[model samples]
Target: MPHRTYLTTPIYYASGAPHIGHAYTTILADALARFARQSGDDVLFLTGTDEHGPKIEEEAARRGVEPIELCDEMAARFRSAWERLDIGFDRFIRTTEDEHKAVVRAFVQRLHDRGHLYAGSYEGWYCVHEERYWTEKDLGPDNTCPDCGRPVRRIEEENWFFRMSTFQDALVAHIRDHPDWIVPEVRRNEVLGFLEKPLGDLSISRPRSRVQWGIPLPFDDDHVIYVWVDALVNYLTASGAVDPSLGPEAPGFEDPTGSWWPADLHIMGKDILTTHAVYWPTLLMGAGVPLPRHLLAHGWWVVGETKMSKSLGNVIDPLQLQEQYGTDAVRWYLLREMPTGSDASYTPERFLVRYEELANVLGNLAQRALSMIVRYRDGVVPEGDAGGLDDAVSTTLDAVAAALGDYRLHAALAAAMDLAREANGYVEAREPWAQAKDPARAGDLDDTLATLARVLGVLAALFHPVCPERSAELARRLGLSGVQTLQEARTDAPGGRTVERGDPLFPRVDV
Candidate 1:
């Protein structure tokens, strides 16, 4: 049976506009989803906007608009941006959606019924920006929210709380038993160390009198669910956990139980690991739902050595990049430059450098090889004699296949391109144009053309997920159908398909 993979980015908060960080995570998820599909896995990719919370309410009020109106407009902007970026998400969920509300309510009621929730009166320093109440020491030096750098107001209210403290040992033990569940040894250590301290009961509801922009609590009429609780349920809601009527039409619609239940991986930014890796699993455990198999926390994309912030005016609009550079270029740069679980900086100079190298060096080689075949072979794909070609071509294909099998996309792409580089050298050494004049060297020309076609076919397969449009174009030009898998390209090959010489694969851009 094939595997099932579900990947998601944190539902982005709508109080701020979409930025490069948003694009980075979503695009990474999209690439992973695409790769999984190519590798014969059923993939569910979810992305969306988080439309509730105090920050959103404040932004709406400041703009003299209702919260729903504000969310509608911001969510549209996010949708437009993702569409422009070609993020092939399985579903775009909104926290304000009716389906989502039902899921959140059900999730909360499950915990309540299990005795994991309690009605309580609480007093603490609340950060409107963070939409979270913080203990006195959790506040920063300026008496503000530590994460958001905003002033906190001391408030007292009646609310519902989750017994997060009750799960401390279980969470710790879970982490210890499944060390690989949390990615990058460093992040796992950080989560473990944080859990070593006394855990606090998490406030799960906010007084509706104070905030009315969230999902209403199941038992309490005066309070709405907190942002994290409202937001995190999106994962389940998108999977049809809340509404039995929806059936498999949910996000990972293909194999809801077999491969899709208990997600194979949950990708998130480091800031939310506590919520996703810690609170989320605990919530699942309390509700008797299966915990996700893995939680991979990646670092943030920092601007000028600090996290991107709207106040600093450093938040990058991803659409601008998509418009200036094509979608595939932007997508490739995000995945290629950032190592999983590491931070990557975005700069125009760096992007331009990479574009030039890929376009001029790797792309040009394939173009030249095909262009030569069209010029000399009358657009006929010459058949290869596996026993007759240079040994280097076979060696490169073996290495490329090995890299691809291991999920090393960047390395695999490089190895695949190296075949083109070798073919180019062979063309240079043989001087095919000069060799065409001698009838004695006819076999040499056929061998060279065949080798080039074989290498180009392999590249089309390897690059299909990363650059789908370009790969299809290349495949058509090489007289082959759009390939679905690397293995398909290698076996039962299209040996004598007609070749179409077209424009350059990666067009050069001036930065």
Candidate 2:
């Protein structure tokens, strides 16, 4: 049965231009969305920029531009980058949008009405860079912000607070009940370890006098919503679960099944795991909303064992890489090189290795099979059985589905690569060139050529999720309109169509 699969990537903080880190999460979600669609599921893939925060205000002042002006520019850069990299997100949501503001206001108001919110005061160390409050214990040595290694300032302010602590027991119970709610096992245990201590109420508002570039609290005009509060509601806003025009007693307010709420999966880097797994879920509970089905905290892309950071000047701009090696190559390298949910290093040498795998194995197979069909059989695919390779294709298709079901994307690509290798080995064993030289071997040659053509067609479908463009080119060369689904590929096994040989799908790249 086809079902809706709602997936999301964290709305990137719009304080700087996007880098490889940003590309990884969006591309990962894009590949998953593509696979779901090919498998006949309804998918809503959401990604965008988080534009409200003190960080944005500070960055704008340094650049001598209004916060909104800076947001407009940065958001465009992110959108442009995703376009170049073929990120097919269904909705590019911006917190600055009026619709998003309406949803945020309504959500906070619901919390306030239910007594989940209260007036509070706080005096603590605040990290303007992270837009978060940090206790002394969380601060690093020399009193730096633990997350970013930046200086913190002492602030005493009146604010609105959500009754997050009130739900701590329930949250822990839910986590314990659903052990797989947070993925990668290690992250789940991390959140559980944090829960071993007390959970405090979340400070959900800041004074407008201190941070003016945010949504003003719906219940209090003197204060504005905390950036995380406004930012986290983006998932709810895009899910169509909150109707700003309706009151708290509305039917849809209680039952959000009609919309895409309770997202199937939320994808983000490990740095923001607490925001999604803890703060976001408790916030939803307070608003009488259901929590997302799953949370995935993937590791970072590092350089020399250090997380790539713009401050260190180690950030890799994906668009620049795309300019040299097409978008699919960049996508392939990121998805194939990184083990899903684990840190992977970024190096030119490793990238070329993956590229050559494409060039020498998958790309080589396409070149050989299609060119031979054009050369040996007058440009038409010969009709025959899949030449004893039927089991290989079936096994690969099952492996891809199983791996993707577990969100093990690297494993899925590995399965497909193995199939490509198997096809190459089959080519060596059959040796159609020798078969074509003898009159008595005509039947054997037809079966060999048919088998290669069939495998190439299947490979096109298997690789479509990770490398859509390259797969489409291969499908076109196989005389198909475009890449097909697993079902379509299994049944169509290239035969009786004119095949065209084109340039290699992935030409070898030199360092």
Candidate 3:
């Protein structure tokens, strides 16, 4: 059986529209999934909208519409944006789905039965925007929510709480035991620092009177499960683990054989590190469900020295960029510009720089190689020894694999780009055009064209995950139905196949 890799992006909040930040995360996940599939791994990639929360309710009221209506509109927008960007997610889950609600109720009921939940009276600062409670120390100096720096409200009411504190020590031990459980050393250190403080019990429910737009607790309809809890269960809900209709004694929770539970990777922004690293693992432990293997917390996309935010009007619309520069260009700029685990600043100058790199390097090489093949070899790949680029291709493939193993997306892209540059240099050194003009060097010309064709084959695979559309076009030009894996391309003899030279894969863009 092929190895299975299950990956997920934190479902985007439906209270707002999709932005470049959302695109960045989904694009990264999509690239990883595509690469995994190409490498003979079964991949399950999940992405969707977080449709239930106090923020949604308030926004609906402000717009004079039902909450579900708002969620419907925003969810559609997200779906459309992702489709436009060519994101190939396996499942686009929504929190409002009947199946998801069922799983949430079942999971919560198990926690209650396991004595991890209790009824309690709570009073603290609550941020409507973030839908989270903040203690005195967690608030800003001006008594605002620390996370969003927004004014918070004080609400004292009866609610149910999770015994999150009980698992604090265990969580710490797990983090210490597996130093790589949380990625990007900085984010891991951040979680550990947060844990230095005593872990407090989490308020897991809100009274219906206070919040009417969340999943009702299975134990009590008067109180609904908090939005974060409802949202986090989405991964499990999509994993096909623990069918709610089968009751709590089912084997699905203990054995995830037929399901994709215990997800291999959970990808999200650094802002939500605590929820995934701390809240989620403890919740799984409470319900006797296996925890995900890894959590990758990536940095945000900042603009003007501030994180991109709708309120600040700094959000870049990825759809617009795709419209102007093509889907692959947008995806390339994002993956190439941002180093994994670190924040990246967006600027038109930088965008054009990355775009030019593609057009001048990969695109130019593709154009030159195929055009030369057509001019000298009648649109057919020449029969020659392609061993000239063998060592370089092997080295590049190894570097790409190693970079991807570490989840360094930018590094992987750099390695592929380096191979393109190397191939271009090879074309310069070999001088296929000069050889074609010399009757005495006919065999040398064939070797050069054949070596270039082989390198193009390898490139089509290396670039496919990041820029599927253009890579497919390049493969079609090379007379292949689609892109092949690096392994397949390494042994592929490109000689009898007919080639068609065409326009540049990435056309020059005027900034």
What lDDT does the true structure give each of the candidates? Answer: 0.76, 0.90, 0.92
Determine which window of 10 residues in candidate 2 has minimal summed lDDT: 245-254
The positional error of residue 103 in candidate 1, measured at the CA in angstroms, is: 1.6
Better candidate by TM-score, 1 or 2: 2
Writing each residue's lDDT as its tens digit, candidate 3 over 1-511 gives: 9999999999999988888888999999999999999999999999999999889999999999999999999989998998999999999999999999988998898899889999999888889998888888888978898878889999999999999999999999999998889998888889999999999998899999989999999889899899999999999989998787976665777787889998999999998989999999999898888889989999889985887877888888898999999999999999999999899999989999999999999999999999999999999998888778999999998999989987999999999999999999999999988999899999998999989998999999999999999999999999898899888898778988999998888988776
Model 2 deviation from native, Cα RMSD in Å: 1.2
Candidates ranked by lDDT:
3, 2, 1
* Model with the higher TM-score, candidate 1 or 3: 3
The TM-score between candidate 3 and the true structure equals 0.98
- Give candidate 1 regions above 4 Å deviation: 242-259, 304-306, 386-437
State, as a TM-score between 0 and 1, how close model 1 is to the true structure.
Answer: 0.90
Q: List candidate 2 segments past 4 Å from native.
A: none
lDDT of 1: 0.76
